[model samples]
Target chain A: MDKPIRVLVAKPGLDGHDRGAKVIARAFRDAGMEVIYTGLRQTPEQIVETAIQEDVEVVAMSILSGAHNHLFPIVVNMLRERGADDVLVVGGGVIPDDDIPVLKEAGVAEIFTPGTPTTKAIEFIKQNVKRK
Target chain B: MNLQERLAAGDVRALARLLTYAENDYPEAEEVIKNLYGRTGRAYVIGITGPPGAGKSTLTDKLAKALRARDNTVGIIAVDPTSPFTGGAILGDRIRMQELFTDPGVFIRSMGTRGHLGGLSKATQAAVRLMDIFGKDYIFIETVGVGQSEVDIVKTADSVVMVMVPGLGDDIQAIKAGIMEIGDIFAINKADLDGADRTKIEIEMMLDLNENKAWRPPVCKVVAVENSGMDILLGHIQEHRTFLSESGELVKRRARNIRNELMDLVRDRVMEFITRETGKKLTVDDLVQRIVAKDMDIYSAAQYIMEAINK
Candidate 1:
């Protein structure tokens, strides 16, 4: 049987508001994906470690603490260092449109703003998540 | 030459990979566990849980260090809260234990609750089993302080330590019910604070009200930041272990835990199978519509769904 896609949803930095992250987690669960949520105030190293330990197909980071530029790339680099560069990296939460391109260039597959529907994110994962 | 043998020999990379395979319910995980299962049951499993800011992480670090000093290898599974919005974990538990990373004798992994209603991750028990097989002398499972669910998950441990701090305001009321009854040891952390004595007394009072069992839980005072009272706490942990073994409840409890784990795994697998078989043909919305339109009652609808799979 084909395995369920495993996704790690991480909240990077000092962001304390986790209601949104919880909602997305449920959405992914309902979509029949296995999700591991690392709770609030995670550093990039912690996120990478969890993603590796969980063997997730995707690492979706939600940062609302305005540290996305610092946190996101650090996570990508760490995952690469850990030989998990094949895992799809995505970001969400209040990212400016102009910054999205820069984040994408740094190895983030896509960035979702607040209003983007859960289905769209799910669909993106379905299409982009590479199976080993 | 199986994965379990490799794990038992202290192969960190293999252990990490095997744990992931197990977490995903991969078929090979069963083979690995089957090979390693008999090698387990040697380690002492300790569960440390409390509310956030109770200094659970700091206490865990201190405890790990103490264990390391005794030349006992330690395995830690820290259950961090998951971001509900993104289905991710902000795994900050490791921040306090960074110094142990290079210590070959200590292996620490942070796991997210992963939307499990229980405070601990669903994969936690399995991970503990893996650690036990890896020949750790002590394994500590820490929860993110959400209350009852945390207590339930920790019930699988051989000993449970509920950490509390002074000035938490409702410390007494919080420990009055549910998980409170399950604690084998209570630590009033931050014992240097003004209300530390009061918190200790409250726990003592609670214990006094309860009838004495063969093993009475002890309350210790500790300042985790300063690493004081750690020796006494370790003595209490050893005392608890001796209590469990002397009472012969350890084997019985482990048997029950194994039974519960087996049932949970079966239920999860069966549910996944049924969902996959039926979900392809019918949406959850379709089932809802059928029930709402009175075409079928909820039970009959469920029966019909089950019948569809059998057919």
Candidate 2:
């Protein structure tokens, strides 16, 4: 059988509101994607660490604590430093439209804002996942 | 370096990648396992299982902690149920095991029992083998011990520890036939809770009813959160390991496990070949169409497929 797309749904940097992350995780699962959710309040380092350990093809971060600007880039840079730049990074949860291009420049493939449909994110992952 | 060389050099990323390959049953997984097969057979595999809410995760955390304290490098595989519809799983075992997260000595992975044709057990064993090859001294396989599916635990672990808690009436009755029979060591967790003694007595009584058994499983009472009775439980595991080795049961059990693995792998290969062949010509849909139209009976279709397989 074909290997399912492995996606790590992480809530980084003290984001206690995990309802969005949980929802997305479930959505990904329902879409037949293998998701590894590392619960709430994870660090960028821990998130990257888990992403690598899981050998996930995508790292989807749901940040509501407004630390996405700081945490997301650290995760992206960390992945690059670890020779894992090929792993796709995406973000969701309260990310501003103004910051979308910035995050994209920082290596985030896409961002699903608060009103975006979960299917959009799922499709994004399926389309953007870097399968080796 | 290649995966083998990196793994031999103690690279964590290499280990993780190998484990992923094994868990997904990727084609490269077989090659990886074959390459590392000679380096395996070193880690002591212990399977921890019990019904849901029996504190299996908490107990696994404590056990991994104890093993780490003794300077043993540990690998943990916590298996949770996957959604049959989505093929996705929310593996929350790691939430209870946060302490081991940052510890370099411990490598923890949570797997979903995707029910992909008995794939959970096979993936788990493969993960265990990868961890073993990576040089972990102890490997723990934690499963949601509900039904007969948990029999896979026995086939994988050198010693199987069944965790239970008191005050849940019919808990033993629910799992008695399958899980109860396979436990090498029984743990009544939450010993501080009421009926702990009664639960212990129940298991002891159950054991007493059995006859002609060379080794009897011991019941250990533990308050997992307090970390009490863990050392004793570890001691029992060590004792069981020693007994298995001394009695030559280790060799026998491992031989049986390998035989089962070989058979399962052959079955998987056969299925893969058939699927590939059917994809190219004579799709399963075509067979169904024939059966529906009464052009081919199901039994005859099976014979035809077998014949095709042979050809």
Candidate 3:
């Protein structure tokens, strides 16, 4: 049997609201994937270390602190440094349209803004994970 | 491949990847688990739970550091809350334990409840198993300090620690009923506060009422911010581990945990299968219309759906 996709959902910086993160975690569980939430106020290094330690195929971060410009790139670079370049870097939470391309360029797989459905995120993961 | 071999070889990357696969309930995760299951039972599982502001994160950091000082490798699993809309976690535990991130002897992973109703995420057990396989002497599981669900999740630990603070008014009473029974060690953090003594007494009162025949859970006071009383807390943890081994309940408790995990996984899988099979043929609107028209009773309708799937 194939393994379910393992995702590390992280909140970076100091945004304390987690209602959306909790909802998405439930959605992924229902979708039959294993989801690990790294609680709030994480640094980029910690997020990458967690992804490496957990062997997560995807590292999805939720940042409402508007610090995505700094945090996302650092996380992407750290994953690369750890030779986890294959691990997908994705994020959500109040990212403006102008910054989406920059985030993608920085190696984030995709950026999810508000109103994105849980099913959409799950589907994106299912489609993109590098199958072992 | 054997888990011990994988771990002894220092394949931290592989160890983590395997844990992730296992936690997700992937079909392949089962084989990985079967291959590595016996390699587990060596690591001590400690569950840290309490109210939100009790500084559970800070205590976890101190404990990890203390355990490392004793020349033991540590694996920390911090369970955070998940975002509902995006299915992501607000991974906050790293803030308190950032110092340990660079330490070779320490590996920290923060996890979210991910909308699991029972307080902890389903992946937590698998993560613990992975940490065990990775050869950590201690694996610490910390939950967001809610109530019943947190207690339910921590029950899987080999030893459970309940953390409390002096200033979270009425929270002591609020946490009394469900958490009081499962705690192997009670920590009243922020002992520098005015009511620290009162909080300690309250915990003692609760502990006295629910004395265990096998082991007596101790109440210790600490100021987590200052790293006070950590040594005593570690001592109590070691004592509890000794109690488990000596009482012959270690294996029994582990077996029971395994049994519960298997049942939970089976239940989850069965529900998924039913949902997928039925979901294709029936919509919520369809059921509502049927009930509205009095064509079928709700229970019978459910039975009909189940029978269809079975057939």
Candidate 4:
């Protein structure tokens, strides 16, 4: 049987504003995926460690704190250092279009900005989740 | 390297991969575990259980920290409920456990019940055993918020800590059946809340009526999020462990748990046998149709199945 995609919904910045993260977590659950919501104030190291420990196929993070330029790449790089680069890393929450290219350049699979529908994120995960 | 080799060499990724295989029940998992079964039985499993909105996760996190401070490795399997309609789950138990996320001594995994009825997933047994083989000094299996009759934690845990909060109920709620009887330690979490003393007293009253006095269950008041009273709670856990060993109850309990596990496996194997191809013309599908159409009673179907097996 095919496994449901396991996504780690985490907020990897200092921001405690997890409304967006919670919303996406709920959306992933409704779409028949297992979501491990790691709650707020998670650092990049914590996020990467969690991604490995949970063995998640996708790490969907939300950062409204504008620190994405620094933190997002750190998580992607850490996952690579841990040889878990196959995990589909994605991000959302207040990232500007200018930073999208930068984060994508750092190996983030995709970046969803505000106003992007939850269905889009769900579809993106379904299509890109790495299955070994 | 093969999974067993890497696992023996202390590979966390291999351990995590095997856990996934175990959770999914792939055939590969059985092969690995069958070979690694002999190395298990060293880890002490403690079960943390309570109703929803209780601080079970918080309690688990604090307890893991305490154990780590004592220089022990801890593996935590935290269970949450799956959505019955969508067949999905939001496993948010580890949200309370992020403090221990980067700690190498602690490994935390969250599980969804996955339509399993007893507040634990069917894969929980395998997860526990895998953690045992991974050389953890202690294992904590925190169940999904449980009500009466969801007591599968007993099958996996050497000691059970039933976390309770103030104002969950009055007299009738305090002494309810099924769950109230299983605790080796009754921890009144959220002890800063009102009526904490009353809740503690209520559980003590309930314990007084129990017939088993070999080890009287202790009632401890704790504020889990504050890290308050955990030393004493851990002391009680260690006390119970010593008591079990000194009293020879550990052997008997482990023996009984093995019995329950054997029965569970047998039931699954039998059901699989009955449902799969029988090499005969008659099938369970036909038997089910007949029963649903009222042409045959369920007892007749069972008899027919038994007879077919005999033939």
Candidate 5:
């Protein structure tokens, strides 16, 4: 059987607003990707552990809190240190435009801001996921 | 090191990678499982199944924690439905069990039932074996929110804990026959709700009509989110485990399950082989398309399939 692209959509840091994450999870499912959604308030360690255990090719986190610059890169680095560098780590939700380049330099494959269509994220994952 | 050595040395990444390959039916995973098959059968498998919104995942999280507090290594496989049209799924069972994410003693995997392949239960059984080989003391297989007739978990777990909640479809769901009989233990989660006792009595009445009375399935009230009644639920599950052990039914039951799973595995493989084309030959799918177009009959298609495989 052909394997579907597996993605882990999580809400990291203290922000509990997960409307964006849930929307992406649903969109991923509709796009024929198996998404493992770990609900709100996850730490970076918890996110990376789940991504590893699930063997997900993509880790897409949505954080509304102002800690994306701090927490998102930590998750990316942890995945790399854990030998999970193959995973495509992406971040979304309330972040300034200037920090996007910094996040990209920190090994985040892409950053989807609020107005970015879910299809763009889906397309990015399709083009970037290592498993495919 | 090889896969077996890595697994033996407690490599989580290797285990996770093997599980992916196993689910996709890769030959490397088959070789590893063949080598480590003897390491299985030591872990106790518990199946948590119920309708959607029954709190099975929450109950599962609490149960694993309870077992972990007693220093037992736990493995959990939480199953969710795959989309029939899109072949995708949202395996969000971990949303409730996220607290166990970092616990080295617990391994939780979320699975989607891609029935287009029809090998879901087979892969699930293999996953259980792999987890057992990984040295878990208790393995919990939580089924997708099931209706009647999705009882494949019976072929995987030694004990099936059927979860129930109050006010779901009223008394109709309680009286449903097929899934109701498979519960070795009945848990009325969200028991703090209004109709809990009524649901309990409904289960008792139905269980009294069970054909095999060797063991009486206990109906326990539980509020999983608050963690109340968990101890009693744990005690009852333990007691049921001991009963199976004492009466020697555990061995007999496992053997029966293995036999059934082996039969399913053969069917899965044969179906896989038949659907794909052999060189330039017409496969079963093409034959079916012909039958649909009235260019070929069903009997001739069947004969062609038989003859092609015989070659």
Candidate 6:
């Protein structure tokens, strides 16, 4: 049997709202990916830790709290520092268009803002995950 | 580092990959398990199983929290059913376990029954071994405990806790399902409900009918959602663990489990070999056709395939 794509759907940084995270998690599961969801109010450290422990190919983070500017890069850099550079980091949920470049430069693979179809993120993961 | 070295050094990534390989039946799974087999036997595996909607997951969360409170590192595996059409699964057991998400002392993984593969219990065993090799003190395997087909938990868990709610009105159903014999401890969750005392008494009455029993299964009342009475349940689990160790039942049971594991592995390998050989050549189908045409018997055809494989 082939190993299925594993993704971690995490909500980081005091985001009490998890509706978006839950939706993405269901979408990922329906896309045939194994999704381990670390529920609300997770720190960047917790997200990265879970991503590594779950052996996820992608970390799809949903943060509506506007802390993406501070937390996203920390997760990307921590993944890099821990020799987990292959773990692709993606962000969504209320991220502004202007911060896209900075988040991309910080090593986030892609950012899906509002109205982005779940398939777009699913396709991105299928296309970009570093296959072994 | 190689996979085993990385896993031994507490690399969660390595551990996760090893489990994936094992669950998917990749060739590396065998090599990795073989290399790390000696490092296992440390983690005490506690299985939490009950009918769906029986508060098994909530109880699992409370139990993990209690175990963590004792400074024990915990690894949890929640097994849910797989979707046949998409080969996917929605493992939402962690919904109520949000608190453990950030706890470094805990590691959680969800597995789909993957009905095609037909070995959710075996996959769970491999996951438990990985956590054990990673030095977790306790491992929890939670499965939707319904029907005899899925009772594989009895074979896998060191001490099984059969969680029950107050309103499940079938005392004889548990016996029919063979859950009564396998439960090392019974937990009446949702004890705040109307039938709390009645449920406890019912299970006790059923247990009283059990003969030739050395250690009686204790029925502990708990409201897992409220985190009430968890300490008492944990105390019972610890007591059972102690009894198993001091009475040498632990060694004996583990030895029996090892035998079962070895036999299952042998069967899996033999079946793998047969499938590989049969896939390359259409021998099995041809034999079946011959049998259908009344030219050969099924028994002889099976013997012929076995002989060909041996050669």
Instruction: Please tell me the TM-score of chain B in candidate 4 relative to the true structure's chain B.
Output: 0.97
User: What would the per-residue lDDT of candidate 2 be over residues A1-132, giving only the tens digit for each residue?
Assistant: 456788888888875899988899888888887788778888777777777777888999999889989999999999999888889999999988999999999888998999899988888888878785
**RMSD after CA superposition, every candidate:** 6.4, 2.4, 6.5, 1.6, 1.8, 2.8
Q: Candidate 3: where is the Cα deviation over 4 Å?
A: A1-51, A54-81, A87-132, B1-8, B169-176, B276-289, B292-294, B305-311
**Best prediction by DockQ:** 5
The candidate 3 chain B region of ten consecutive residues with least summed lDDT is B168-177
lDDT by residue for model 1 (B182-291), tens: 78999989899898998888888788778876877899999999999999998999999888799897888788888888888899877777777777787556788989
Higher-TM-score candidate of 1 and 3:
3
lDDT per model vs. reference: 0.80, 0.83, 0.78, 0.89, 0.88, 0.83
**Chain A TM-score of candidate 3 vs. true chain A:** 0.96
Residue B210, model 2: Cα distance from true site in angstroms: 2.1
TM-score of chain B of each: 0.92, 0.93, 0.89, 0.97, 0.94, 0.92
Could you give the CAPRI-style class of model 1?
incorrect
Q: Judged by lDDT, which candidate is best? A: 4
Cα lDDT of model 1 overall? 0.80
Query: Stretches of candidate 4 above 4 Å error?
Result: B278-286
Worst 10 residues of 1 chain B by lDDT: B146-155
What DockQ results for candidate 3? 0.23
lDDT of 5 by residue, A31-126 (tens): 999999989999998999999889999999898989999999899999999999999999999999999999999999899999999999999999
Chain A (candidate 5) TM-score to true chain A: 0.97
Candidate 5 C-alpha error for residue B154, in Å: 0.9
Listed per model in order, the count of residue pairs whose N, CA or C atoms clash below 3 Å is 20, 0, 31, 0, 0, 0
Q: Which of candidates 5 and 6 is the stronger one according to TM-score?
A: 5
B178-247, model 4: which lDDT tens digit per residue?
A: 8888899989999999999999888898888889899999999999989999999999999999999999
Q: lDDT at B121 for candidate 6?
A: 43
lDDT of 5: 0.88
Model 6 lDDT tens row, B175-206: 56465567899999889999889889889988
Winner by DockQ between candidate 4 and candidate 2: 4
TM-score of 4: 0.96
